[model samples]
Target: MNNVKGKLIIIGGAVDKGSFTEVSFDQNVANNLNFFETGIMKRIISESKHGEQSRLEIITTASVIPREVGPEYIKAFAYLNAHNVGVLYIEKREQAHDPEVLERLRNADVVMFTGGDQLRLTSILGGTEFHDILLDKFKNEDFIYAGTSAGAAAASNNMIYQGSSSEALLKGEVKITSGLGLIQDVIIDTHFVQRGRIGRLFQTVVGNPRTIGIGLGEDTGLLITGNGRMEAIGSGLVIIVDGRQIKDTNLTQVELGKPISINNLVVHVMSMYDTYDLHTHQMEIRNSQYSIPLMAEQDSDDADPKVSADDRE
Candidate 1:
């Protein structure tokens, strides 16, 4: 099944729910309006083929406030005229195996994961019958799997569950563990730019040189196809970390708690209307007519695209 086709909408969290301070508007109308028109949440809903008739299942197991999280998504989608939204409240492992939950998943047109704790998400849902069924539908059916923040990070095989920017590149500082494994050969870090996660992402790719790393900025996302073609969406950047050309690594020589170093790593900073081919490691700017250099500096502090090599030198 090399050519299995499905849609994956992985999003960064904190999508705008509208400005609460805006005057002269009814609270009910404002709550049910399309507040974040350019955000990943709207895109996910649009990508689903069923439109108004789409059967959406929101999984809020990852969130600490599951009760509040599900309703937020419901209200947002309700504004989009999607009346058939349901919540799968699978808090524990046994709940993941519920026959009713499995039935809801099977009948749903789109499955969405809300932001919370990545580790909690995978821990509860991993290896369950529901997880298996979800994967099966994703591969064989015309299903759309969408997630934000922790939900987005959980889609990868190797998930960066815990890590702080202060000690990101240090050996043993970055924590990685098995995720939902919806996607392979890559690691995902969400709320990337907002949380300053580039250091950890760089560390992840350097350690697993063959694997790619995706750092998604808040409100930004990638609509990735099964063939490894990624289309960037939303207002913020999508940082792609490629370690295939890395050299002169000192990770092995360093002690477990020491700093790690590597050379010649390739990084790409992408925004809306950018298309990248993971298979070929190529990028194309859809909005621009002429080709421009796609390389970015390795500094996590400055997220702006760098033009000169001397800037880093």
Candidate 2:
């Protein structure tokens, strides 16, 4: 099995969705669209180059409705290759589950789940022999992981999603189901604003008043280190609802059919280049990349292509 310790990135939605339509499969051009301009994501790719992390073993668990993952998904590898990082993808048999898929997942260096239907995702992959092997892979080093949209939701111990229905978020309308629990204890909702999932996310936080709810909008993502530090990266913001310190919630006051009005809940909309300290549950503006010294940047990226691993500083 591939070592698993390293940085993790979880995107909200819009992962490699539009690139396949392009006639030319330019790795650079296609790659640029999938990743953000923020230095945090760059750092994830950069660290992998120097062995501070390992290869990205991407897993697309969602959109199993015969969704195709072609050359476009490998674009991240191209970005890594430019920086001299290796990459690989686990091939799945079309139209059904492949038994060996679990073994491949166990040995991945960096596992990533793709976007699609949340229910379809869990229905197929959850509680299966495949999901268990993937979980076993969670305990090694030189490996990282990531996910997007429905993929992001699956990272949490409990996931928020609309399975077969297109229901807007109301008081009790939000549905919660078991996730793979890699991230553990948080519930995730993707395509937040565009899908109007705020009310549903609120319903989730207010109802429990103990779990953290992370709602990621499209084209946005959270870049996190294993030490409980995370930076918000992308063009938009990540909405965080912390109910751990809540005093009261009227969720149970309303019946199952009614939409409940929530009050006094603390919410924050974090911007890009900002860091969230998960341990302290605080948010602060991260130092700009331009502020770091040239030597610091190079030392962080000092993986010489011509030298052997023994020669690395």
Candidate 3:
């Protein structure tokens, strides 16, 4: 992970695919900006080794309506002049072993997963040869792994499968399982602010305090590259919940249906252009003229609280 050559673009649900259904909003105010205009997909292309010529593959294994979802992405990429893109509807585990499928994946520069049920993605593709190839490429090559919604949720090492937003505060209400292991020591949750799922993330981090929780708002995403450096993208917010400083928690002592309690949980609200270092637990806010450094722990009483441009690397 220290020398990771690949990149991850984890997007929240409701990304604009050129349909223009509705303009993006921030804090309930219409921004009239879409993902296309915001340059999210364009960033994906630019980050790739081949730029627009990169062979992009869309995996719709998580989607129930792959036919509908797949075409929309194709059009979206086409609108960006990326014509080499294709969709792979791998609905069963058997399809994951197909030689042709593996070959196409091996040749692809970017492989993106579409939104649906996160469990479906883990169940069908967890131990397949296809999964192995993707993992190897991501670790060794200059690959780009992008995902949206359910796809984004399953990109981390841990995934939340069954959890109701309204009842997430109670013990055993938020369910978690092993994910694709694309990223370690982190958990991703999508459609965060719009669905009011911060409580779910809170419970998860409380249970596993070492893990970092990311709540990505709709139309928003994190562009993670090179040793856990994440940059917020799109129009909405990205919430980072850090439980490393937690002093106490009643989660283990609570009953299954009882609400849990935790003390000293730290949270940082990030917007577009904000950067966070997962390794060092440092944050840099770009919206303001000064760079606000939210460090995990102060080195000394006189340590500068501001993050300089050199500290970002």
Candidate 4:
């Protein structure tokens, strides 16, 4: 999807989906657990305490059904619950379309997509009634949605969700596919630096210089404003590749199965409070995110980190 006005919170992977919100519900499904708490967890935890409905929700179609991930996203819940927010899970979206899922998504203030596989996220939800609902929901300011790993990748115009996080952009390795239609100005990649995904993200932008590429590190996310400007949130960095300035050579001849050579590709790093203009391609240093101050105002209550919190290990 091109540009729709909504928020995108991209994570490294494995954000706790259930406990983050303050709402209560009977468990109807389950999924595996993995990944850690990027600093965003702390923010959500503090917010849920006031019992004021915060804007955010999570969708884990990427890890849906037997691979359910609701139980796995506790840190995310701890953060959301701290704010008295609500979190919901949706499984069985693989071959089924449930309208209630969309209803819940529309009702929630923030919508989150958990990590797993970008293909799964898109293949299951794209074009479905629920997917349309998400698209439609973006038109409303009350909604702010986030995703991680595959989820983060799926929020872009194009997604590279499959494959191990190997840095080398080998031929036939950078598999690209359609995403949730949230942010279409760029192609999104996750587990960025750790996974060595820059080469692939760079390659995509080179092919289509008109398109920008964003590589978000594990536990790292980009806080994009409604105006299309952005800030880096979390402990890690979000990489932005700008191919617009490049006067490139020879990539059309690059064939599959054989590694391709890439020339100079402009890359930028976005860390906490960094501002990036999606349209003007301008990068700035901001005092804080216009809305939420990342890590700066963390009231930081003493709480044990999740059991698998160090997923990067």
List the global CA lDDT of all models. 0.81, 0.62, 0.86, 0.62
- Where model 2 places Cα greater than 4 Å from the true spot, the runs are 1-6, 15-44, 47-54, 65-67, 79-100, 163-169, 287-313
Off by more than 4 A, model 4: 1-5, 14-38, 42-52, 64-68, 72-89, 93-96, 163-167, 286-313
Among all windows of ten consecutive residues in candidate 3, which has the lowest summed lDDT? 20-29
Clashing pairs in 2: 3-141, 4-140, 4-141, 5-140, 5-141, 12-149, 57-110, 59-112
lDDT of 2: 0.62
| Tens digit per residue, CA lDDT, model 1, 1-313 | 1465668888876433321112222345445233375656677777887877889999998888777667667877877778899988999999988899999999988998877888999999999999999999888887888987788999988899888988898888999999988888989898788678899988999988889999998667899988888999988899999999997789989998788888999999999989988789898878675644355333444654555667756
- Candidate 2 lDDT tens digits, 1-313: 1233555677776433422212222445554354545443455465552443444555554654323453445555565453233222323333124545555555556665666666666766676666665566554455556777776788778887652124433455667888876665568888776666777777778778777788887677887676777778777678988877676656677676665666677888877878877678887766654577778889768766689888764
List runs of model 3 lying over 4 Å from the truth. 15-33, 289-313
Q: What's the lDDT of the predicted structure labeled candidate 4? A: 0.62
* C-alpha RMSD of candidate 3: 8.4
Looking at model 2, how many pairs of residues clash? 8
If both were scored by TM-score, which would come out higher, candidate 2 or candidate 4? 4
Estimate, for each residue in 216-286, the C-alpha lDDT of model 3 and write its tens digit: 99888899996889999988899999999999989889889899888999999999999999999999888
Q: Write the per-residue lDDT of candidate 4 for residues 1-313, one digit (tens) a residue.
A: 2355555666654223322211222253232212223456544333231333454455656664422345435333553443333445545463335665556666766666765667867777788777777777775544566776677778876777555446346566666778877776688877677657688776677778888888877556777656788778776778889988887556677766556666677888878778888878899866534655646446343334663448635
Query: TM-score winner among the candidates?
Result: 3
Q: Can you give the lDDT of residue 24 in candidate 1?
A: 20
Q: Looking at candidate 3, what is the lDDT of residue 1?
A: 54
Candidate 1 pairs with clashing backbones: none
Cα RMSDs of all predictions?
Answer: 10.5, 10.5, 8.4, 11.8
Better by lDDT, candidate 2 or 1: 1
